[model samples]
Target: MTVPSPSAQPNSLRRRLMLLAVGCTMLAMPGAFAQEVAAPATVLPANGDEIQQFCTNIADAARDQRYLLQKKDLEKLQAEVDARIAKLEERRAEYEDWLKRRNDFLKQAELGLVDIYKTMKADAAAGQLELVNPAIAAAIVMKLPPRQSSLILSEMSSDKAAVLTNIISSASDSTTSKEPS
Candidate 1:
């Protein structure tokens, strides 16, 4: 075989050196390979409030390059948030109105019960136990605290009060028996 010329030898040496340099750079900087492998750079929108805005801009630009999301999807998400806020405000107003009406009704009913209790007591002392006993028992059931009402019923005539006491005892027993395990 013929020996290679000196000029050819130098050219070969330079080519080998260039290849070695590229290999060493690839080993030293792995990110260089990704840069070489990816597509061209893209421009992004300028307006941004923070680093997240800048990152979002870059992500949007990347997505546009990749043909991902359209503008309509972004608008739809914004509309959904707005609708949820409006619904929450409407529910808050409804709850406030319900609370006001409930308080007013409870106040009126309590006053009416107090007037009935006064009338029943007046009739009971006038020897109208027959008429007053049932009214007084009903008033005690409706107006007095549960424990106090039970005690008062226990002290009344056994024949009449026994019925109210049985009702109360049965209610209490059912409540206790229905407790969750």
Candidate 2:
């Protein structure tokens, strides 16, 4: 058997038949042949009066939708803020409770310390207090009896004695007036 040469006329005929078959196949498929047409664009108003009239027609509905969205956004923000405030309040309560317990412990310790300082000899007490925090030393000195305090002050350095004396006087002053007491 001999193979025939591809002729130009036969090639053109074949191509045309193939195109016709493809066209028929496309028509047979509902989607290919009947694709939805693009939506017709609405005509925009030309003049200012016509544009204003269009805007006026839809104003109330547009405003209501915008307002609704804003309201929802505000409500969400309010809820978040409220949650944060609640968390802060809980933390504040925890802090206050911890502070109260710490203060209570310190108060008991301070009383014990004051008692110990009261029992020590004035010279020894002055020596020990001088090594301690000035405010604490002053507070201890203030708690001691007048005679004991005087003895302690006499034993301490002049500068230390003066500071302690000033602290003691200031602590004792109960006047609520703005003037120096």
Candidate 3:
């Protein structure tokens, strides 16, 4: 098969026929032969009003996004603070409960020690108490009735009794000072 050369003749019948075929094909599928036309010249705002409006819209959108992000951050921080506060409140409540239990235990022990001293012989109790803390011995003696306290004091050496008496006096003064005015 031999390929035909392009016709140089201006009015060649074959060239006219080829041109007609191409025109028909281009018309059949307009999109395939479509040219990119320049967009219609936009009428811009001469007074800068439209430009300012567009800038304002962009700024408003940016500000809204920033505000939303900040709101989310603040909410997270608030939730964290609330969680910390809840934990602190729980710890405080636990500490208060433990303190109440400790105070109750100490009071019961003080009463039990007072009872033991009341039941014991004065001389032996005095001797035993001398071996114990002076504060504890004084507290126990103070809980006793006047006659019992006098008997226990009499059994104790004068110096020891004097020491116990000073402790009791100071303890009483401390307690009095702590009372609401």
TM-score of each: 0.31, 0.37, 0.39
Best candidate according to TM-score: 3
Better of 2 and 3 by TM-score: 3
lDDT of 2 at 42: 46
lDDT of 2: 0.67
* Clash totals in order: 0, 0, 0
User: How would the candidate models be sorted by lDDT, starting from the highest?
Assistant: 2, 3, 1
Q: Give candidate 1 regions above 4 Å deviation.
A: 1-70, 110-112, 115-143, 148-181
RMSD of 3: 19.2
TM-score of model number 1: 0.31
Q: Tell me the whole-model lDDT of each prediction, alpha carbons only.
A: 0.50, 0.67, 0.66
- Cα lDDT of model 3 by residue, 41-60, tens digit: 24433334544644553564
Candidate 2, TM-score vs. the true structure?
Answer: 0.37
RMSD after Cα superposition, model 1: 14.2
- lDDT against true structure, model 3: 0.66
